[model samples]
Target: MQFLDTINFSVPLLANATETVDSSMVIKSVLLSLVVIYFVSKLGGELSNKVGLPPVLGELLGGVVIGISILHLLVFPEGSTDSSSSLIMNFLQTTAGLTPEATPQVFAAQSEVISVLAELGVIILLFEIGLESNLKELMAVGIQASVVAVVGVVVPFGAGTIGLMTLFGISAVPAIFAGAALTATSIGITSKVLSEIGKLNSKEGQIILGAAVIDDILGIIVLAVVASLAKDGEVDINKVIYLIVSATGFLLGAIVLGNIFNQTFVAIADKLKTRGGLVIPAFIFAFIMAYLAAVIQLEAILGAFAAGLVLEETDKRKELQRQVIPIADMLVPIFFVTVGAKTDLGVLNPTIPSNREGLIMATFLIAVAIIGKVVTGLTVFGQPGINRLAIGIGMIPRGEVGLVFAGVGAASGALSKPLGAAIVMMVILTTFLAPPLLRFVFPDETTTATLEAASGTSLVIESDVITLTDSQENELKS
Candidate 1:
């Protein structure tokens, strides 16, 4: 199979010698960028792991070190389209006027292509997240999880909106986008920590995981609404309602219809003896959903998420997930590194009074983010046997999803560069801090079963529902 096709040059060249030469240069530039980005990103991930931080933090930092914001080493045609430097830039000028106003540049045409691939990386990343989610398991977690998810979304969003407006005097639309950026919880980091501590199957852990899934769904809807509002340049109540309704309906319709389609496609693919017969169709389903999502003015990741959720119910799920990972591993880092690269660190220089405002904003957002998730943990009060603080800590890390929100907002021009940088700063701080806090909250549970056994008592929340308790009511108050 031809893999890494986004960066790989496999298209047949024209018979004309000049055309072939031009294509070769383009291929070389792309290959060079990939080599540099991959190696640096890997190094960053390795370093982050060494420090007990998520590798995503390291990848993001690596991008900053090598990107235009720092070393000024990586250069892409941001607004320039010089034919001599970039064939793609030249092509864009002729076809789409991609070069803003008037500008010309060269060589980094491949960088533009890499940016597109980076976008695809995040979409695939979201799809993988969806694949990992079990709809039944999420639903079964019940009201406690729902409350946690809702509080997690609302608190940070509100904090971000009010903080940005008050601190930076930003308008409502941009402030809301900033708030949306803070609403996501990084499931990957939280799940890994839970697994390492042997708490992944615990009641609290289950609630955390379920809540994070719900958070992603809610965050995406917020992103859609905020992005639409920013694009339209006016705050129309009717438009907002339409966007909310459309996003909700699309998600429901896609899941229902996609499930039926998955069953039929799987049945047909099962009859085929060809290799990759199953995996290929599954990938196609994700791709088609992502395309359709863009058509409806929703983010492509939403479509990807739906595809993953639908296919996750099929018999081929394990194999499909296994196959999707390698692709995700290759592309996902590009997204993180690009996000890091795009971040302007100058706004974070606290020594300068002006730059200090950005730092203050970041600090405030981080507090909001951390407190928001901590509040989520407290909301699990109805669930006995679960550590409320632990659940909240688990939901604290915004990680990749936060970056996705900030990146999308920045790309859409809904967030200015400094605000975007500040958001990234908040993501970095939260991702770094959550693990140690989670460890502190849940000290020595050897196994989830052991924890469940210890929680032999129950607490009633709603009429018939029961939760296990490890602490007395007064102890919880303290």
Candidate 2:
């Protein structure tokens, strides 16, 4: 109240007292929400690290605590359609540029702004992922990665769809959505784990990373088809075909043209002596590609990924990576936290009669999700000496993509509350499961730092060097 008074008295406003109060209240609400999110996210991340869990998991748990489903600390109402809640709901709806007629639709719009910001966060995150990827490395592992990715998609989709229909007696349409949820591998989670273990350059790690990128593209295509089926009674084969062709063409074309653009950009920046030259242009290209991907009925992250690949081939790759990381760090948590916030645990409780069926279905999906990916380990038989189990385990987490599929299904009415909750649980569990398994199977390689004091030699810790030949090991022992 004191703060409100100071603001009102200080700013010479033309508006009435009530208008000022309302506006101030709205500002306070938004500021308070952001404060809670940042503080809780950091706390969650720190606690998660202490327990040997990924910070991402902690950040997500933090969101769940402060979100509507748990503490009810967030002011965004879901289903209350009466009195003060209704008034606040109406105000939110009006702010969203709606008629404010007060309906169930108004309830969903309450979090619209937050949802948009969360989406932006994910877009930026993907851009950073793309920037880190090397096109040459991706191509080198293309054949093996493509095979792994294709099989990964087929197995999980089949498992989820077939398992749901058989065990839970779910109908066809909803089963498809459940299957879609299991398809995409979260590159962010996989990459973080590999980097932590210092195996990112390992052959197994390379294949996993390459395969994950491929899976993302494939997953988006699957999402498009399922979404199309939901909207239309029959499948539009032409649209599906177009998505594949267009996405392929866009990425390829971007890479080829982006190389030329990169050279020209560097040349121009050198000649003109311009301030903040290439950075702005590079960002513009990423955002434009992101926008174009959305325009063409694919996920924006795809375009962002392509943008990163384009930039990866440029001379400014290192500088671009440096510039993008800070932005990604700031925004990525918003995406993860919002995803966590959206998850409703109540609907997945087995004790609830209404939720029992969903719980059973969720259990089935989780089993399929695990087994399907685990079996993918054997698919890398062509490459001997590589730990196939590590690759498979790395591919398990669904992360942002699964949440996206579940959200789409729920919004489209193809999935009920219980079923959506089930998918969320499956995603969370898979994310939680993969890291420890990877660590156990492919333990961190001994870094040069570990050998420094004893050897006193500046030997680089290459993956190949870590695995010494028999003679080398014998000599070391001697």
Candidate 3:
């Protein structure tokens, strides 16, 4: 009788312990995934640099190697792999003694954490871009940029919509959504490439940056309008007006607040009496700005960008920029890797019968995607000597913005499989090709640097912070 009682008590304890262990699996999976990400990012980045391409491309390809299409090691829910399908989950099951019953729940929790990290990575990226940018120059080119943005949106959107409707016999709503996807200029991808090539401060770069910002604002409004049409078959005028007003108000308010907050921001940074004083205060402001943008139904990255712009005007811009770089380098690869990992290249294969039709449809999208944004450079009337080709090439990538549209259309049942696959193909090609194409269109600055360096003009690594050369600094002051 005593033995029976002991067994009953132990049974309950065992059940409790199982529950505890199951919950802890999420942490284990997350830890393992980070290890994989870091390894892939480092390997990819190094290889890319060796090939004279951007390190980001290498990081992205590394993710693809480890992700669903190749190794199936780092899969996500959006990529259509659940715990049962994930190699990581299988590894945990065999190695870590993870029970099949608890696997799905753990996998979900782990994926959420990674996704959040990736989102934060992008927010930080946009903030870094804004900090590197000259706000006054962005403002100076505002009129020209707006024209470029408007022209960029109208051309691709109109052309894509009309072509899809006429050629493919697609419905109005789906065509409109597809057209909307064409209008996105991934500021993240474009800005990163510009920074990598050391053209982020150029005249074309400023206009491209300015136009990209306006493009995002307009894209949001267009997305809302199209999404509504998909759902209800009619546009909500009130919602459209609200989006316009709120987006415009948020940007204007951020700029106004930047001017007002600079003095106070400096005061707070000065009073901090510990390590990370400067960067911590700066991030606090950035997070607050990000939160505000999200609260107003705007992109969090926008607020982070606005915060950076505000702080860029401060006395500590150079120090702040340097401080932020290490943090950025650490987190930014996660964003790029995840993007590559999430990409499913299987649909692009012409070996599959269904994929062949999609490939044909994709041709149209690919053409429209390239031609639409390339024309925006011609819209710049006053900026003589601007590299028009470079400016337009800078706007080519659709990146995650395109994915959002494809996902929404698929979710809403507005797009057919062929059309959706075509859209994805367009996004993948543009995103992957833009960096190389952008590098191509711009002048070979590296050769110029080499020639200059060989002509008894030595370059110096002043510090971890990027110090402009004396000539470059003089030009900036002038």
Candidate 4:
């Protein structure tokens, strides 16, 4: 009598091994993701519209609700794996035979896929954002914005570091990591809120947007420094400086190279028998730039962002944005959902209050997070009728930027598990909290219009005006 090895021949294996087999586990993951995405996105949009908040805020809240630690407990009894789990192994195990020990390998494979998808999502997002952004407008306000951004980043970072060191009794590295976490301005949330409130083109909005961009650059530098300090006991001040300097240099070089290449590429595309071939080259250029940025220890999204900025000046800019949007729309939501899925609300459970230092730490970090950005509002000089408070609040949400920092910190071992957990909680809270607060504080078009009128700044409108055809205007209004 021959007996099959049940462990080696599970349902999951066959499902993963053949796409035609229709593995239940893969189907489960996909269906669950779709259901989660549809309901969460719909609920988020509906709630935000009802509350006069940005739909992104709703989506984020949806993410929080659908997260494994929250709604997933009732929906999926088996906990969701990290973004890095292996579907093949999962399938093999279900279809063929696999032991619990083999599951980790599956997880490792899945993580790679998640990372790639997340990366592509972010790149597309940044590119689209850049396409919509007015560089000239950003440049005109850059100096004042830079001042506000620098002060905002510095004060909170200092205060948080001090609090962590003195009040929390944490060591230098952990404190620094905490401070680093406090540095990012969640641009996505801020932009969405500003757009929803019709303040996106106001002087205050311009300053906030420019400042947020500067904040991102500064935050990445701080992250590099903190990561270094976490690795070695002492901070490598020189290395940190070098990274910043190098990143700036790279930015300049890329801008120049991109401009030259874009002109040449456009000329070639104009002559091409099939204009569609231009997209292939454009994507290739984007990938190369992204790769180069990664090689220099900078985030690839920055490169993608730069590429988009450069491409915007060319005739094909609209085409590129149009082409990328569909792909971006589909994949970007996955990134957001994955981010929300990572929330382990179990960490916040107070059942064992004595063992909840991480939650306490997270609360403290949230306080620091709020205080730090609020202070930036005070730093806006010479702009009368500017709600510095509003601007600061606008900068408060951590969103994707915070995630990037948390991801780097966790991967580098600079963040202890407790600290990392705390940071993530702080991120989720700030992301969820900022939109509602902004809506309450800066409510209505009248307030934004009043502020814009008082500032005598037409800079905002002139800057954000994307060329609109009659058809496009009709579409937008609809």
Off by over 4 Å in 1: 1-22, 75-108, 142-145, 163-181, 184-217, 220-234, 397-424, 431-478
lDDT against the true structure, per candidate, is 0.69, 0.70, 0.83, 0.67
lDDT value for candidate 2? 0.70
Of the candidates shown, which would achieve the greatest lDDT relative to the real structure? 3
For candidate 3, lDDT tens digit of each residue in 1-478?
0001111122122235355435467778888888898899999989987877878778888988888778877888774677786788999999999889878767776776677778788889989988898889889999989999999999999999999999989989999999999998888888888888778878899999989988988888898899899999999999899989998998899889889999998899899989999999899989999888877767888888889899988877878888999999888888888888888999889999999989998999999999999989998988778889888888999988888888878888999999999999999999998888887887555322322343568654532135654466555466
Writing each residue's lDDT as its tens digit, candidate 1 over 1-478 gives 0012223233223234253334454455566567768988999988976876557667778887766567644445442323344333444446644443322212434555667777788778767766666756655675778789899999989988997898779988879998988888876567656654556656887788768756766776676678778888755666557656776687779757855876787797789788888778877888899887776656676677678778877766766777888988899888777756655556557787656656777888888888877888777665667678888889998876787777677767887766776887888778767766776787753222212224676443432112223244235545
- Among these predicted structures, which one has the highest TM-score? 3
C-alpha lDDT (0 to 100) for residue 406 of candidate 2: 77
Greater-lDDT candidate between 1 and 2: 2
Instruction: List, residue by residue over 1-478, the lDDT tens digit for candidate 2.
Output: 0001111133212245253324443343444556667787789888987876667777778887876567654434333323234344444455544343433333333344455556677777767766666777767877888888998999999988987888778889998989988997887677766755666667887788878877887887898789888878677899789979987887778768766776776676466556556566777888899889878766676677778777777666766667777777777777667656655666656788977766777788888888888777788856778798888898998876777787678768998776887898888778768767777887545455334335586655645235444455556677
Superior candidate under TM-score, 1 versus 3: 3
lDDT by residue (1-478, candidate 4, tens digit) is 0001001222243335343233343344454455556677677778878866767677766766766656541122123454224333444466656445544433333333443455576666666666556556656777778888998798878988898889878888778887888898866557656765666656777788878867877887887678777777667888778778878887788668766877887887677777566676677777787777777767676677667667766767777767777876676665555556555566666676643787888888899899888888887777788888888888898876786677677767777777777887788888878888887777563221112333465423333235555465455466
lDDT against true structure, model 1:
0.69
* By TM-score: ranked, best first: 3, 2, 4, 1
| Higher-TM-score candidate of 2 and 4 | 2
Instruction: Return the TM-score for candidate 1, rounded to 2 decimals.
Output: 0.71
| Model 1: pairs clashing at backbone N, Cα or C within 3 Å | 82-104, 82-105, 85-106, 85-107, 86-106, 86-107, 384-468, 385-468, 385-469
